[model samples]
Structure formats: C-alpha cells, structure tokens
Target: LGYANKTQLESLVRYDLSPVLTNPGLIPLLEKEAAKQKKRVKITLKCETGTHRQGLLLEEIPEYTTLLKKTSFLTLEGLSTHFANIEDTSDHSYARKQITLFKEFLHRFEKAGLPPQRNHIACSAATILFPDTHYQMVRTGISSYGYWSSKETYLSFRAHTSKELNLEPVLTWKTRIGQIKDVGPDAYIGYGCTYRTNQPTRLAILPVGYYDGFDRKLSNSGHVLIHGKRAPVRGRVCMNMIIVDITHIPGCRLNDEVILLGRSGDERLTADDMASLAGTINYEVLSRINPLIPRRIVP
Candidate 1:
C-alpha cells in the first residue's frame, strides 16, 4: 500500500481493503483519491523502526503525523514495522532494539492523538519467538504453508515449550513419468554426458525440470518418489525435462504419478529435503516453482 499508485490506491479503497502506507508521498495521493471516491480509507502507516526498508523515520514521523491528521477521508488505522533480525537466528538483541524504537514511535503517536488502532510487527518468526510483538495482528508468511520459518526458529520454539505445534505441509508438487526406456551399459544420459549407466538400467523421463521450478541443482544429487520408492536423478536437470532411475521401482509405467515434493503413500519428499540437497532454503525451493503450471487445491 505504501508504494501503491493512484489507480491501485483507488481500487483498494473501492474494494474496501485498507492499504499499508509506507511512503509519506502516498499520503496526499491517498487523501485525494479517497476524497474523490467519497470513501473513508483506513490505511496502515509503516514505521521504519529498524528494518529501514519502508516507513517513516522517527524524525519524519512527527511531520507525517501532522500531514496524516489533516486528511478528511484518510485515517491512519494501523501502525506496523518489520523485524530485521527476527528470523535466521536465535539471537534477538537487534530485534529487541527495533521494538524499543517502535515503542518510542508509539509513545509519540499517543501524545499526538494519532494513535493507530492496530500495531503489528510480527512476522512468522516473531509470532513464534516473541509473543509481545503480536500487538493487534500478525503477518505470517512461511508458517501459513505449514512450514517452519527456519531451523533456529523451530529450535527456539522446542526449547521454550513442551507443547506440540504440529505444522503439516499443505503443498505438494507432482509430475508423471512421461516415458520409460531401457538403456545399455556405458550409455550416456542427458546433456554433457554427466551420468553414465554402469549396468543395464531403466529410466523414467519426467516432464518437469528446472524450468518448472524443479531446481537444476537437484541433478544427480536429488531423488524423487515413484511408487512410494526413491528414484535417483540420473543426469543434469534440463530446462523442461529430468531423468530418474526407476530400475528398482517395479510395476512402473508411463504417466505414473511421481512425487516431486510431497507425500507418496508412506514416503514423502519435502521442500526442506529439496532445499538441503539444492544447498538453498525451503522457501526458495517452494517459491521457485514456475507459475505457469496449473495449481489445484484439495482438502
């Protein structure tokens, strides 16, 4: 909402959605748009506590507070900030510093009689690690998908509480065996001759590849689930194709459902596993999936 243009801001107001305003420049624009629409626009002001990504600085907030108070249709309904060091580690000294700065900003707002009704700074990590950051609302990200924010966040949660917090992953990436073929011994597979068959081998050609968000780094080092069994990636991951060794997986055929990153019978291939094998994070593994692919929602 902070970077929203005139048209977007108008649309948000029309849709009855409050936008988060970060830039002071957007304040006047929103006022004009809301006045034109004759609609009351409740906007959340993003205060730059410590992230330094968006929001007004402490010096800038006083002036903006004056400007925001002058608007007839635009109301500062919420105040928000983001924690810079809330994730990725257990040390939270910097996050605490940011919260202290936020409290100072809140104090000023209260004195100015422009106190926002909502104050939010909790991302997924903050929601789990620090209960105090949950003022009015929480902006959860990775945890919504039933995935932990990070190993450290999970560890911190485990160390603090004996209660169980079960978060099952809801997303599953699936593909089908496009073709199956037998290869002679010493035959090279895929581009660059990266994988050579030492013995007579059976391979399953998959229609998905790095282009579809199946990471290219999974080449040779990664495995997939087929018939509830593991199939090792046979060669370099291509733009639109990947080959997996299905020699041991019996009763395999073309168009057999393959689990790229999901449960298959009693077995599962998680984004966390893919992240580790690809030398990346679970978020990247899930977000990197190509958007062109059709997504289906199931219970």
Candidate 2:
C-alpha cells in the first residue's frame, strides 16, 4: 500500500498501519519498532519483479523471509511488484514476463510458509490489458479519470477485445480570454518574434501558460478550441500567458471562455492532444496541472 523507511515505519507501526516494505534493510528497523510497540506490524513485501526502480530483488526474497521469521512482531501480509514497460508500447511480452516472475515468487513465498494473504502486480495498464495479472487488487490511476494510458493501450484493447470501453473525460481546463488585439500584416507576435503574421490577425490572449502546466513547447504548435473552431497558438508561450490566432472567429470579445483541454461546442481538445504538441504523455499533461487551481463539478 505504501513504502516506508525507519522513521516512516515507526509512525506506521504507531498508527497500526501496514505498508509495503520495498527494501530488506528496513526489516530490522521494523522489528525494532514492532518490539517497542509490543504489537505485530503487518507489512506487504514488494519484490522487484523487473522494474529496477525499487523493491527487493527476487534473489533477495529468501533472505528477507529468513529475516521475517527471526522477528516476533513482524508479519508478512502480502506480496507486490510493479511493471515498468506495461504502458510504453503495444507489446505485452515484457509485462507477461513480469507477471510470470511475480507468480513464481508468490509460489516460492507460499512454499516457505510465508504465504502472503494478498498478491497484487497489476497497475492501470496491466489491469486493462491482462486480466490474469490481477491477482488480488489492481491500482487504477489515469484510466480511472477516463483517459487511456496511451494510444498504444487503446489500440491494443481494441485489437484484442470486442467490448466497448466508454471513458468520459473528467477534467476540463477552462479559462477566459484576458485581452484581444488586432495586428496589421507583417506584425510579429510574442517573444522572439516566433510567429509573424502575413495577413492581418486577431489575437486572443489566454491567461494560462507554462506556469499553469500549459507546456512551453506548445508555442506556435498547439491549438485551442474557441467558437467551435481551432485557433492556432502564436509565438512563444509566456510564463503566464499565451496568444492564439482567432482571426476566423468573428464577434469575439474579452472574457470569452476558452477551452484549453476540453470540449467547446462540437470541437474538443484532449490531454492527449496537448501531450502530442508538448512532446510528452497524457499523464504528465494531466498531473502537472497546478493543484492550487480550484475544481468544481459540472453537469
């Protein structure tokens, strides 16, 4: 459920909260805390199945098991691992290999008389792509918010199954036009003169930029939805502002609502769209949005 060190483990034990022990080094610290508290502190052991980022390696599980047996107040509650390549591509072979290794370790723990009560290895992508990997519980993240893990994930699902995956976007980034300006032909817009108008242009200034997680790479590349039409971004994206060429949309006024990543009439710009323009993934696009911004539910 969570990873903890010596200090964090002490707090978790005091609160009687079980967490995932990713390192074997923490075993002694956990034993000390459990003994001090005079209560068994249950924990899930996270084995590094393949993702070399964290967790104890498969070769170290037996050593960890031996350490667990030496403690009277430390109980092994579950086993878990994470897949590193499950979301990057359409190929599932690496993920399947991770699942196989996870299962082998789970069986090994059972043979050692440390049969974990729960075994989980699937994250959001694996949960959708490989049902067999869902041993006990699956961690649903971006997909829970109605966004596909990646384009490859969507394609893989459609190619393998006939079931409909209806996901509605839950987040809509809305901002109003801060200012409107009319420029004559040959006028260069924004910093560094990155965008120069050949024809007279009507520019709508949006009060959102890199500071709000609207990536700077979107300069002169991204588009915003306004009046049900695509308005091209002009010049460099400033720290707190961006200009869009809305010359085609007539009758535009200051304070008009702009759709940064959402639906506007018949047009829509999704996190995927912004990610593509920014040279990143949808996860970064959505997660990087400033948390200080207010959120409200809408019908």
Candidate 3:
C-alpha cells in the first residue's frame, strides 16, 4: 500500500490493486491512470500525523480531499499514518501522542464531510500493546511472525495487561554442518585470523553465513544450538561459511542439523538472540534471511 510515482500507479491500475497514496504529487498520475481505465480507482490517502516522512501534512489534507473529489477516477477509501518511535523505547508517550494527532486529523476530515471509510494507524506494536490505537485495521508485521516489536513493548504489555499474549514463532532457520575439524593450540581460524585457538578445539563449519543473512558482526560473538548446547562462533563469518567451536558437543558429525535461529532439543537460538549479538533489531534478522532459502511448514 505504498505507491509513490506514476509508474507504480500505472502498474497498480493495470493490476486493479488499490494502493495507499503517500504524497499529493502522485494525485495527478493517479488521475491519468483512472482516465485510461475509464473507471474510478479506489485509493487510500496516507496522512503525515507526526512521522513527517511521507503522506500529506495536516494543512494539505483538505486540498488533497478536494483533488480527490474533482477526479471521477479517484475514490477516497481510507486514511492511514505511521508511527516513528513506537518500537524503540520503553516509554510509549511519543507513540500515544502520534495516535492523538492522528485522531485529531481523522476528526478534522470527518468534520469536513470527507471522512474516510477505513482508518488505520496501528502497526505491530500498537496492535499488540495498545488496542486503543486500532481504528479500523491494524498493520501487523514482525509480531505476526511471533517476534515482539521490542523488549520494552513486551515488558510494558506485561506490566499493564492481564490478558496472556502467546505468540508462536513461525520461522526457523536451519543449516547443516559441512565439515568438522580439529585445530591445534594457537591456530588461527577464518580470514584475517580474527580468532586464535587457546587450546585444541573442534570446529564445525556451517554452510550458512553472512551471505545467508547471518550478520558478520556475530563473528566470535554469536552462538548456535548444537546437540542442545551453545556452540560459540569462532573467527570471522565469511560470505558463505562460518566456523563454530563444537569441541564440547559429543559425537558431532558432518551433515548434523544446525540450529541457527530455532529450537534444538531444549536450547534455542532465537532471532532476538541474534539481534542482540549483532547489535541490531529482530526485524533485520528476520527480513535479511535470503529469499532463495526454501521454507516449509511444520506442525
């Protein structure tokens, strides 16, 4: 629901897919597409309540609504906005303020007799933590995949709410050990010799690496689940390979299932765990997974 220019609008029109118009500049292009289709193209208008990134400003909403009325092809369907600081901090005051600003704009539009049929502002965090922000629909993103928007959101929800929110993780990243070897004391591993073995160490080479969305920053810091135990990463993570110390894992072998981000026995290496080690967010960890990787559903 993010159409910005004429080309995107044309494609959306050709496919008969409604998109959220983020800027007033696209209005003319939408009109042109509608004229060609000989029918009104239903579209939602995105208002910049506070984010100030995209969407019409408060003063521009009236003019945008007027433009919508002039064109026979443009039908106002919904109003939407985004939260800029909802998932970062423990305090949700800024997010609440955004909601307030959005509500004021919604009222202003209604007062102008151009009230949108559907109004949505809540993203994943708001949808789970603040139900009051749910107007007509909520845009559930990371949380839909069983990851919390942030640890703050989880804590805040638990502090205030009585309802239990059980989110089951949907994605599990798995790879197989390609090689197993033993390195003598003082042996360096991987490129640049970032890690040196202090003692005799058994290392398991995993096929998946930074190219497969494993963060390079996790080199020598991240842990993977091997035989229900934590196997520490060693040296630098290469484009297509990473070596982990598995000396403590009994009977480790080639082609053994490796848990990169999932449960193995009673141990789990979650997206959150990777995010913490990589100094990033869980969204990045999940979104950066290579699309070429096959996905299968399990019961």
- lDDT per residue as tens, model 3, 118-170: 88898888898788988888899988899889888888888888989987778
TM-score of 2: 0.90
TM-score of each: 0.94, 0.90, 0.94
Q: Who wins the lDDT comparison?
A: 1
| Model 2 lDDT tens row, 55-143 | 87767878998999998998888988889888888888888888888888888989999998877887778889899988778888898
Model 3 — which ten-residue stretch has the worst lDDT?
Answer: 1-10
> What is the Å distance of residue 73 in model 3 from its true position?
1.8
Runs of candidate 2 with Cα error greater than 4 angstroms are 1-3, 14-17, 34-40
lDDT of all predictions, in order shown?
0.88, 0.88, 0.86
Clashing pairs in 3: none
- After aligning candidate 1 to the native by TM-score, how far in Å is the CA of 270 from where it should be? 0.9
Ranking by lDDT: 1, 2, 3
Better of 2 and 3 by TM-score: 3
Badly placed stretches (over 4 Å) of model 3 are none
Give lDDT: candidate 1, residue 91: 83
Of candidates 3 and 1, the better by lDDT = 1
